[model samples]
Target: MRIGILGSGNVAKSLSRGFVARGDEVRLGTRTGSKAQLAAWIAEQHLAIAQGTLEGVTGWAEAIVLAMRGMANPETVRAAGEPAFRGKVVIDATNPLVWRADGFPSLGLPEPESAGARLQKDLPGAKVVKAFNTIGHAHMVRPQFANPPTMFICGDDPTAKTWVTELLRDFGWSSIVDVGGIERSRLLESLCVLWITCGMRLENWNIAMRLEQRI
Candidate 1:
């Protein structure tokens, strides 16, 4: 599958390499039309293409990964042209991280409606599946915990969620729990804050989370 990741950050780079190593064609999208780092990455990975303009990447990919900032998602989609994402499965890996005046995190989306919810409404026909938002980029690609970690995914489209769960499995995430529907994206997005806080506050634990089944 051809995956288009819309970001130039650590998450984009990590996922890009992971997908490429797994034999999927990966193209990363950036606002800036620069290819220097992307070129180096392609050479290092032995992959032909690496980065592209937002529209270029979206046009070339069968699936789109909305891996940009949550606040920037609307603009990124707008810039990429909403039609490019129509009827496509978009794997959303963003969080609502607003910088408060008191220098803290705030919610980017208002109550009842989450960032992913807003994204789904805005994109219309796009199948928006929320995944990869709760984990750190360092552990996103081929995470090697003593026990394989769980990846929580939610989307209104069941087929899209299934496809994304398989993709997560390819990334070394064995346990996939479909948290049910797109509205659950709110809890998943907030999980990022809690995960970040714990990782920063605690000294012993690295980036890791296991979803256990007691049944």
Candidate 2:
């Protein structure tokens, strides 16, 4: 599968490497096509092409990974050309984080909505699946915490969620949990805030959530 990733940050880099390792064609989208470090990293890893704009990357991909800031997704949509994203399986890994003076970090989304839900609404024709937002980028690739950590994925499109589940398995996710449709995205994004606070308060960045199951 050909994967297009928006943003040139750590999450994007880690996922790009993961896809390349899994033998999938990966293209990275960023504001600048030639960031020397990123270019060098891609070359060193022998990963896929890195393009300056979202349209170029999306044009080369069968699916897209939305790794940009939650607040910046709309702009990314405009930059990628809304029509181009139509009917494509867009894996949304963004969290709705709002920089506010609340007791702790909080979400930018409305009380009942999530970043993934907003993306789905904005791109009505596109299939948006919410995945990879609850965990930190460091644990995203080949996670091995002595136990199989759970990855909670949600989407309105069952096929899209299945594709994401398969992709997660390839990246070493042994426990895959479906949290239901696009509406559940709000809950997933909130989990990020909770995780962050726990990490900070406990000084345990390495710790992440997992779902236990038994027969």
Q: In candidate 2, what are the lDDT values of residues 139-194, reduced to their tens digit? A: 99898698877889999999888888988988999888999999999888988898
User: Which regions of candidate 2 fall more than 4 Å away from where they truly are?
Assistant: 44-48
How far residue 175's Cα lies from its native spot in candidate 1, in Å, is 1.0
Q: Candidate 1 lDDT, tens digit per residue, 1-215?
A: 88899987878888887887888988888998566876776687676556789998988889998888888888998889988988899989999788777554656787776878888988888999999988889889888788888788899999999889888888888888899999989988888867776765774335777788799
Instruction: Please give me the total number of clashing residue pairs in predicted model 1.
Output: 0
Runs with alpha carbons beyond 4 Å of true place in candidate 1: 44-46, 100-104, 203-205
What is the overall TM-score of model 1 with all chains considered together? 0.92
